[model samples]
Target: MTPKQRRLARRLRQLRVNSGTSLEAAANHLGCKQPKITKIEVCQLGARPDEVRMLCELYGAGRATVESMVTLARTAKTRGWYQVYDESANPENIDFVELETDAVAVSNFEIDLIPGLLQTEDYARAVFKAGLPDISADIIDQRVELRIARRQRVLDGDLSVWAVVTEAALIRAVGGRDVHLAQLTRLLEVATLPNVQFQIIPTRAGEYMAMGVPFWCFRFDDNYGTVALDHLSGTTFLEEEGDVERYRLAFQHLCSTALSKQDSLALLRKYIKEEHSEWERRS
Candidate 1:
């Protein structure tokens, strides 16, 4: 099993253990055998929404808190947004991806490249190459294929995206001519979709709560929200109310300073046209 699967298993175990509760005691709370609890804690089987709710209640989680976990379990089988990397990206913590995919709406405050969920295959590859210079060429190619496949996930889900992008991401040149053009084209196409709303926040707008923090905040049914923050090791999921609230406020502030959706699309078009013009001059 992968680290993610191990983590989910461990988290459930720790929640009980940390409460100074025994397996049998927790099992009684859920009206299940100790072995059943063990199976889920070992990631041997996926937990059902009702069972997950029982576990949360046994752990002393509040109604709002337990409801969130229930929703997570309910939507844990949804298709991943990173379908492009389906073959390459591991399916260890696939439950997390499923939760994001089923989210009714997503709010994002991005400082660099577009949010991964909003990226096209070409744009995703371009960004990946910039940081993963040591990755093998064959591996990079696979990664690109994965990202392209992932981009199509929005079409498969009842997903709505509200995004705020920093001006720097727009100006940065990545993946060379064809790649960048393709990326911009993809963005335009995505923007035209009925559920998507995107805007650009020029650096001149100044800073707010997201002055330096960038995260993908996904909102699900039953008021469940997950904020994934980039870190040195990997991604960290924030469940604490304070952390989630901070991200929500930061996103609101970023949106306050960003261009309106219509103007933002126009800006993207202008940027793309100018870049192509410059490419022709250089060629």
Candidate 2:
């Protein structure tokens, strides 16, 4: 999920939680049941255009603020039809759908899945399968396609991205032998691009991923940096000044531990060579 959706979900949740608004009160105002209000507030349910309008009025969100949110929620829904695939497609992914393609500088720390912005179809499919173990086959494929498509947008678009990958990511082999091989090659392909930077934090570097999973920190031309945490429930974006500063420091620590660009490329190249050699030996 991009940071925006995380921010929206987080903001709405905070407002309700802080304002001491009861489900019955908000629901009563919206003419919907308490469960509906709960879903909207928690971002579990996709917000309708009119529902957003109504909720903003009930929440006493300011006139301009309400308009901006209504627009954001509408943008959240217009998803170019092809966006149906991402497994993380919730308020977070949707909220940032329109903004990410416009970002100038982006950095990510991937503890588990490929940086969402850089994943290949097979790798994405494998990740999605693990996340939605019970999903039907057709839906899984659609979602995988969507995820790969999103990654391609970042890779192919005019965005500059720096991704720091934990060593565990390289070793886990998300999609089995063939899938792993393809994903590794895909990384090598994108790593060659001028606007993209990729680094692998090897196990020898150790202790980082084990100590805590990685999160992404995004910086936009708006002169703000956002820290996002992805959870099983989806993603949350941190906006508090202290929280944002802490993430900046965390990213700097991670950057210091990650492999240098030249060495990181060599490591990936070596992995590719080893993969084919092992494949040839087995054959």
lDDT of each: 0.71, 0.70
lDDT per residue, candidate 1, 95-116, as tens digits? 4465465567888777867777
lDDT (10s digit) by residue, model 2, range 1-283: 3344444555565556666777798788877789987676556776666777776677767777667666656665445544553453544665444445534667788875568777778888888889888878787777666665557656665678888887667667788789888888888888878888888888788576324656766665434556667778777766665787787777777778889888888998898888878877988
Which portions of model 1 show Cα errors greater than 4 Å?
1-87, 90-98
**Clashes in model 2: which pairs?**
5-92, 85-143
**lDDT against true structure, model 2:** 0.70
Leading candidate by TM-score: 1
User: What is the overall TM-score of model 1 with all chains considered together?
Assistant: 0.71
lDDT of 2 at 11: 52
Residue 151, candidate 1: alpha-carbon lDDT: 50
Alpha-carbon deviation at 43 in model 1, angstroms: 11
